[model samples]
Target: MTHRTLFLTGAAIALVATAGLGFGLGRLTDKTPAAAEGHAEEADHEENFIALSVADAAKAGVLTTTVGRGGGSELVLPGRVALAVNALAALGAPVSGAVERVHVAVGDHVSAGAAIASLRGAEGANARASVDVAAAGARAAAAAAARDRRLFEAGVVARQDWEASQAAADKAQAELRAARAQVTAQGTPSAGGLATLRAPIAGIITRVDVRVGAFLTQGGLVAEIADQSAVEYVFDAPPASVGAIKVGDEVLVQRPDGGEDSARIVAVAPSAVDAGAAVVRAKPTAPAPRIGSIVSARVILAKGAGGLTVPADAVQTLEGRAVVFVVEPKGFRATPVITGRAAEGAVEILKGLNGGETIAGKGAFRLKAELGKGEAGHED
Candidate 1:
């Protein structure tokens, strides 16, 4: 073939190959939408169920609970364990003095009149010396008054002189009594010019603010003792829920360690606190928790007839709403629920569940996570 003839033939062959390639591309582009639609349909058919084999479910610790009836409405209040007011005592320095010695430490158990510490200072010495002087003066005045009374009866002394002696004796007696009272109020005074600090109530020392050689001013706190045999749970209840809490209502105290104690509402403040929360006090029916422990409280507001109830752990937060996983033959399905009060490990379900529905109790979160994963896969 000549050069011109060869070029024309090559061009024709190239044109045919380009046209075939364009046709193939057109067919692929036309089928792309149908294939994508099929994929979309498959994703749409993906159910919101988490299927697990028996072995897998067992490994996940999936447990089922049947919806039941009977549980009262409860109002949960946040509070801390506090020493009973009548069972607590605050010790303070009776006189300004330097602490000579500290006998007890924080957490020490002490009895009434037990020596806690000793304080030494001029104030204590002066108080004791005044007592001694007052006693001597009183004794001298009493003797003179008795002698003057006898003389007056016999007309051996003037009436004015006898009367004056009697008045002097009475004044001296008053001074003596006042001095003794002062010493008694100051507590026991030691021989070394130290005032001994003593526990006024039998209790466990909860606080000790003084140390050896520490100078304490008068009325300064030395220690705090609490009779924790009886403690009260003081909690702040929302003002909206205060009306439901009445004195004598049953309360459940949940400790930080997951233990529970029963209590009864003893008192409720008439007004709200700074956060518009009411202060409620409850006394434990059994042994109280350690003082100063922060514990959760559930106050039973009212009990109604049998209502739908489920395990509290079964409830989970999904999409910012309370939900529970219902066990189906294929898998578990997440169901939105309206919850009411909760008590004694069970929560009152007002809606979204009928009685006898089997639900995931302990491992519901596993199902929720699986569902989330499936949704994410479909999105991708």
Candidate 2:
């Protein structure tokens, strides 16, 4: 064969080989199983079933409760336990002085008239001197008045002079009475011009601003006492929530420690505060939390027509929808729900649930986390 003919044969052979290689690659791609198997695994993960044995569930604190009927929606607002305005007593220095002694520390229970501190100052000295001088002047005026009466009766002095002496005696006696009142209001005085600071009302001392030997200016805070017995829960409710809450509605105060107390709405401000929130006050039905405790306040706006309800904690948010895990024989299934008003520590389920169904209560979040883990594992 000629050289040109040989070259054509070689080129035709090369083209055939390339076509065969392309066909082989297509067959191999169709046989691969990884992508199909991965998709199947993801479909299974989306089911989100959490399986736990009875013992395991108990260990995980997975609690369940039956659905019931309830009414009302709770408007949970942030609040704090504070001393009632009428029950707060702030003790300040009646006059500038150096604190000579401190008899009590913060948290000390004190009764009315109990001595809290002692202060030595020139003001106390001046207050005492005024009382002594007034008393001496009163005595002299009384003696003069008596002599004037005798002189007028015996005709030894003119009637006008006797009358003038009697009027002066009356004015001096008035000054003495006023000075004595001033001494009583200034509190008990001791030696070295020290004035004892006394509690004006029975309460627990919540603050102490003065220490032994601390110099306090006039009107400076010495201590603060609060009567916890009449404590109030104060809430700053958002403007949108203020309209839902009204006086006489019941409120639930939740402590930071997960404890709860009952309260009744006593007052709602007509306008918002500087923070653009309305101030609400509630009186606790049970013993109040310690003063200055920040807490959660849930106010019941209104009780709607009776409907199916579950424990508030039973509901969890999943995939942007509220869901409750319905307990099954082998595992719990997350069921989406349409919820309505919530009240009395319970939530109203408007749809996706029927009465008498057992559902996860307090520890439902564990199941949600477990489901999330499964999805994340499949994604990897």
Candidate 3:
């Protein structure tokens, strides 16, 4: 064979060897199932992510996100239901007397001018008799005065005599008026035979301090009538809390019978009661509060003005500044923010953040610790 033919034959031989090697390599690469299984095991190791257990999270007081509305803060106050002072009536005797009869009993509803009790007094009878005598004298004097005036007009009587008669009649009339005023002032029935103790205002009889034949002093209370037409809640709170409460602020009244009523703060005592507790007065809705009933008061302190706010737990204290942890794609970041009035569980966000930002609702302390640990590790 010539030299060129020998080289061509060598090249063909090398090509056949290369084909054999390629075929062996292809067979070795054909075990795809085993390689895939190995790769899956390796991924499983990397998938072992860490997370907190349910019990642990609960123990840490971890909470989830919830949408909060306006009106953020309220201060709870303890109070008791009371009768409006104006609605209370103390059935007292205008003169010293013995209770002849109790016209009404406890829990009875009475109207204005309705009799609740009757009193018999010595002064009362004397007052009636004096008024009657004065009225009779007044009629006689009036007739005499009219005759004297006619005589003076006709020039048949001396001017001094007519004037004297007029003066006498005037004096008698004044005496009669005085006697009638005395009777009225004694609470005697006006033109009626019985001196009945009538209700000054319409309401329920909450107390009966007198029975038949009970002796009472002048102006002494005999029964207590409560006009439950309007009820009030009386509260004694600390002076520190007084600044947050004001008239016309909304109040929540909680009853022991599992009932709730709404009211407005109508009054606040100018000074403290017992020099320790401040007096607060509120007027509840209709269906008046039972006298002396106990209730709870929730006075609003701060209200939201339709701004961004978050739960207090979401805020973290860092380096003496109010900080909140915001979870980002990379990790959590401590963000300083300005806050406004806080109510209940929410606080107003005045600055440093806008609404719709996802913040760490809970478990932010753990992230903070992790960051601290990372910093220590780097220092080491």
Candidate 4:
């Protein structure tokens, strides 16, 4: 062959080889069946995550909640929300010391006996020691009082002597009682002198005033907590209407915010004076309305009902099944759930939920309508 012909033939061979190599690599890199299935699953998961910002959620009127077991029996009455006696607590330092840590923040839920903050108690050790000392003194005083009583009864001591001894014992007892109060007011300290401030009752932290490393004085406010669920509805029942109102009646509470909850009559007291309106106190079965909110309360007379429930509006029907839009980190997820009886503007949940899930309330319908747009309105 000539030189030009030879060069052209070699170039054609190289081009064909390059094409074959590219085809082979493309085949190898193509996704396998299993890999393709996995990709679909991931896409599905991403699709399930609804993307809504906090502000949008607020504008949509989405109210979140942790599901709680509730009483479904019902009644209707007008009432105002009020904190239960002892439901509100303004916790202060157990003893004068610098704050070591604040364990909770505003809007956090806390259980009874759970620690909310910790501080080094300057008088912790001394307080414990004082309790020990007082206890010994109390024991000694009791023993002496017993001895004097026996002597007086036996006619072996003057009446005045016995009386004086009794008085001395009383004085000692008072001193001991005072000393013990000091210890109790300041919780027992850890070996390292840390005094943990615990919630007096299960509640929500409404305020936090202590900062880490800040010196707190004894009795200085550290935080404030209110048992959101530990509230009672006070209704003024007319004397004629009061006869029908009785304890143990169920109440469905409607708040101004368009949220609903249930409570049960715990007390019904007539006015101390003549013809005054009777007072009816109902303890809430679910988390309560904010203190001081005027609410419409429905009292149900029946019994044999109890289950996990949320606001009736919170439950929505989609695709022929009941679903609630549960709040998620990114947005809301429509979770299929089994529901029971409906009463008092609320519905019972039989399955498909554990407690402590934040869910959409008032604005639930908006979510359902938005979600009804299917994969079109909500995109991954």
- Score each candidate by Cα lDDT: 0.83, 0.82, 0.73, 0.78
State how far residue 193 of model 4 sits from its true place (Å).
4.3
Model 2: lDDT equals: 0.82
User: How far off is residue 345 in model 1, in Å?
Assistant: 16
Candidate 3, residue 43: CA error in Å?
59
Q: Which candidate should be chosen as best, given lDDT against the real structure?
A: 1
Candidate 4 TM-score, true structure as reference: 0.39
Please give the TM-score that candidate 2 achieves against the real structure: 0.55
Q: Tell me the tens digit of each residue's lDDT in model 1 across 1-380.
A: 69999999999999999999999998877767789889777556355667665357758887887888876656677899887879988899988899989999988898989999889977778888888999999999999999998999999999888889989999999999998788777765754567888888898998999988899888999999888786789998766556657999999999889999999999998554456678899988888767788899877765666568888889998887789888778677888876767778988875688777888888777777888888888787
**Candidate 3 regions off by >4 Å?**
1-73, 158-164, 189-194, 255-260, 270-274, 301-380
Among all windows of ten consecutive residues in candidate 3, which has the lowest summed lDDT? 45-54
- The residue-level lDDT of candidate 2 at 377 comes to 84
C-alpha displacement of 209 in model 1, angstroms? 3.7
For candidate 4, lDDT tens digit of each residue in 1-380? 69999999999999999999999998988888999999777646344346676569878787776686787434345789898877899998879988888899999999988888888865987777776787788788778888988999999988888888788788888988887787677877754567788898788999999899899888899989998666778987655446556787777788898888877889988866786677899888777767898988766643464557888989988877788888877788888886656878888776667767988888788877766665674453
Off by over 4 Å in 2: 1-74, 146-163, 190-192, 255-260, 270-276, 302-380
RMSD of 2: 14.4
Best by TM-score: 3
- TM-score for candidate 1: 0.56
Clashes by residue pair, model 1: none
Q: In candidate 1, where is summed lDDT lowest over 10 consecutive residues? A: 45-54
Q: On residues 1-380, what C-alpha lDDT tens digit does candidate 2 reach at each position?
A: 69999999999999999999999998878744888788676556547577665457768998877888776556677899888878989998877789999989999999988998888888777877887888899889888989988988999988988888889888988998887776666654543568988999999998999888889887889999887787899998765456657899998889888998899999998554556788999998988878789998777764665567899889999998899998888778889876756667888775678777888898888889988998788788
